[model samples]
Target chain A: MLKAPALEARARAISKELRCLVCQNESIDESNADLAHDLRVLLRQRLMAGDTDQQAIDFIVKRYGDFVLLKPPVEPATYFLWFGPPAVLIVGAVGALLFVRRRNRVRAEPAPLSAQERQRIDVLLREPN
Target chain B: MRRILFIVPIVLFLAVVTYFFVAMRGGYNPSVVPSAMVGKPVPAFDLPGPPSPPNYAGPPVKLGFTNRDMLGRVVVVNFFASWCVPCRVEHPVLMGLGPSANVPVVGIAYKDKGQDAIGFLNEYGNPYVAIALDESGRTGIDFGVYGVPETYVVDKQGIIRLRHVGPLTAESVAREILPVVRALQVQP
Candidate 1:
């Protein structure tokens, strides 16, 4: 809603990063909720007033929790959120690698010859044909 | 040692399965994300009063609520509106609280027009001791209200002790809200 294109673009960028509290997954820029509109306007105002992006974001987050941020920062609260997936993947890969190595080790081991097998081999070697 | 390694994958698989079962049976609703404001001080906001309700015989509450007003008192702050069906459903339960609980029930009409907000109160006998307006939805956002009829219980020190999302059912009042409030009242 800013008259200046630069201001409008900045507002849009910030809005996209903020989640619409009323909607399930929509960002503020995309949402049509009354709260979202207020947020968009607020963001524009803050930018126009020369607040940095992070400052504006912090102001909003200070009021509404980190929930309003679309991508929450990696903090104590969101450590699991930020790292839970990679940790799972690493664990799974390690387990799989260990399993594969163990299986290959088993396959590489030579089976000891049974007495019957040894006798049959000797008999075959002794036969002319 | 070799045999144990062979059993390791099976053990790990079973462990994962058991975890899933335990977690699923834990019964935590995914939709109800814990409010960030829980245990923290209520957000600071001072809103202007909306127009007085029509056909209501009483004067309006205050200009608005700031975190200061909430200090040194136990308060039940309810976010509601005329358009919200859940708010209507929760009306009788809110009314039921005043006479029995002997507590102040402060209502903030969330994102509603002045006329409609007042009309809703008129339709459902006003249970709130101090009802105000959040016509711009700014105050509701500050409270982290995703929906209407969500109630919060604040302690004497202005710390948010509890938050009840959605409409308050009778079961919720007796089981959850009252116990917390009663405990907080006796609390220093």
Candidate 2:
């Protein structure tokens, strides 16, 4: 049997990772919102009542839906929300690299400074000295 | 040319960092109150008043007509539950506001039992003038209360001036709540 304090601590740790369904961004541990508080209290109660960690989470998930999870399951429907950020980052990096390479190629063929421009620069440098 | 290349990457990195910072700071926006509710009229709600003395625990006396009568006053409705640790942290701040501030402070006991609510008030020192029992959470639903310790400041005209979706600290009370109350008091 889990000791009371240990159980409470475990519940709190799990709650910190779980989002409060009512307050989308806030964890059940950090949010003082009613639902979060209730969820926390319920979690503690469940822990004390001998519910396993998975059981406690499953109970909440059953009631509140998957939206309460911060790192939601990567299922067919949520494939986009879960993978979207990293995918975007990869795409952006590749695009940036391609753009830089193209720019480098264009710049590599740079025409030598024109004779007229070089002559003007030489005159300006002499006059300044 | 070298300097431009260096500066471009640095600027891009800074921009990405700043975006994450802002997004993290704002956290999540719950669907309870849309951005439109800001500076809009507060929802009209008339709940039971605080319990009376002898049995009177703290702020909320009893459920009565007078409790509902205070509707037109500039009111601050706070939702709290005994189990919420952050609510305990914010208790003193609410207690201090009762006598000092011009607004009427009311408490809504969200989904808590009467005995527990009374015990919580006795232990923490109630700052609310009246505490309504939202046992069924019906009142909470009406107020768009997504969480406990949320304070809504309503004007005399019953327009909600501000809805703070977290615990009220001294700094927040001064910065957010006070100014709105002062403005509403002066308005009509």
Candidate 3:
């Protein structure tokens, strides 16, 4: 553990973003797997060696790739992974808006009655008396 | 136009379903992590050899190997441990690689006891040309090993060409491992 509380906190924050390769879902900070333990130690070693946070993370990413990160970096290859959900949401929202507008337009104006239909309504009203 | 629009959502839903179906049928395993070491030089590691068994008279194959040892020829490196069950299943296939493909197979005892690793080799038949003992698994981490029984194929230049993440089967040996080794061997 770092003697400095600030440095230890910084390390903790960085570790939470790192995925435990063995457990998959858990972060290295939360994982009990031996590999995760080793990674935690390696991360601390890098920090003590005067590596910046990005450098320490990059040291791992160089070996494990972007999958080791809980949040993937925005890049051309991950364009879809990052933007796909919001794009789908926007498309769905637009389609729903268009559907609602069309329905309201249809409801706002009734179709004009034919002459015969008008005469039938008049006859029914006359018989009601 | 309205009818076509009405079918849009259904079409999109089916497209999503078809994608999942195809992926499932293609045997997509979510657990398989792609190795980042491929196409890069093997990580630098100089590991010590596991302790030899008492009164054992096998060839001095227990001498630990290093990255420099990988130079000048094709080599197959396997990460394994006695505690790993799958390693047992893959042991026979590893034994066959040296004879069949004529590539020297190097072994790294990942996080296992020297005695236990020796016992495993004795029972399964030692397939390694040189065995490196990684008791702390620092070398395993350098190699990006998440688990035991991983394998790598290194070319003559000491560049890692391929990494197989799990235990090797006979079929995988023939299809994935042998072809890479063969191609690398013939390269000028």
Candidate 4:
């Protein structure tokens, strides 16, 4: 069995990563809402009472939903929440790269100035000077 | 043009990150009253009072009253539980408000056993006129109660004028609840 202080520290660390179900977005550690505070106290008490780390998390998850986890489980139903952003980033990067390459390839190279056009340009430059 | 186009994805990414950060900070404030429920009459309720226990030494009161009994009188219906810590914190505030606020206050013992509710009232000093047991939370559901320590102020006309969603503080009572009661008193 871990010392009480060690157990408390571990509990705090775990709770900081868990969202308060009642508050939705707040980690259990940071929320001052009554439910959040109650959950934190409960977590600490359970830890002191000899619940293992997994047991503690499982206890909360059972009562609340998977929503209580800050990092949601990478299950089939939650795959989008976990992987959607990175997938968007990768797709955006690839799309942008492809667009730039296509634009470069399709850019109209300035029509090479013919000899007559060059001479006319030279005359215009001289006249301007 | 390419450089500007490149910045779009980055900007979008930044916006998504900012949203997540704001959400993590719990930017959604819970105290704001929902506009939909505001100015609307409170849902009707006729809750059964908790079962009277043997040797219950608290206030002598009956069970089952109508909304009319609550209206035209400044009344507070507080939802509380013995396990809730905030209920303990707000008990004295409710007690103080009972006599001074010119209103009758009632208690809704939510999701707790009768014995526990009686014991809680005994320990806390029954500040309520009557205690209703919401053992199954059906009454609380009718009132749309999300949690314990919620106080509702019903107008003389039986409309729920205001809901204080959390623990009652002295400042909130003075600033919010008192003015509403004062207005209700002068209604013709």
Per residue, candidate 4 scores C-alpha lDDT tens digits across A1-129 of 235677778978988988764566789788886557666766776787778988888866654446568887889998897789899899989998998987887785656899999999989989954
For model 1, what is the C-alpha lDDT against the true structure?
0.83
DockQ preference between candidates 2 and 4, better one: 2
lDDT of 1 by residue, A8-127 (tens): 888889899998877849999999987788888888889999999889888788766777888989989889989999998999899889999989998999788999999999999999
In candidate 1, which residue ranges exceed 4 Å CA deviation? A94-129, B1-27, B53-67
Q: Which stretches of candidate 3 lie above 4 Å from their native place?
A: A112-129, B53-59
lDDT of 2 by residue, B81-167 (tens): 887788998999998886778566877787777667778887877676666777766556445566677788877777667788778
Off by over 4 Å in 2: A1-129, B1-6, B18-36, B49-70
Best by TM-score: 3
lDDT of each: 0.83, 0.72, 0.90, 0.75
- Strongest candidate by DockQ: 3
Ordered from best to worst DockQ, the candidate numbers read: 3, 1, 2, 4
- Clashing residue pairs in candidate 1, if any? none
Where does the lowest 10-residue lDDT sum fall in candidate 3 chain A?
Answer: A1-10
Q: What TM-scores does chain A show, candidate by candidate in order?
A: 0.89, 0.71, 0.87, 0.73
DockQ of each: 0.47, 0.08, 0.75, 0.04
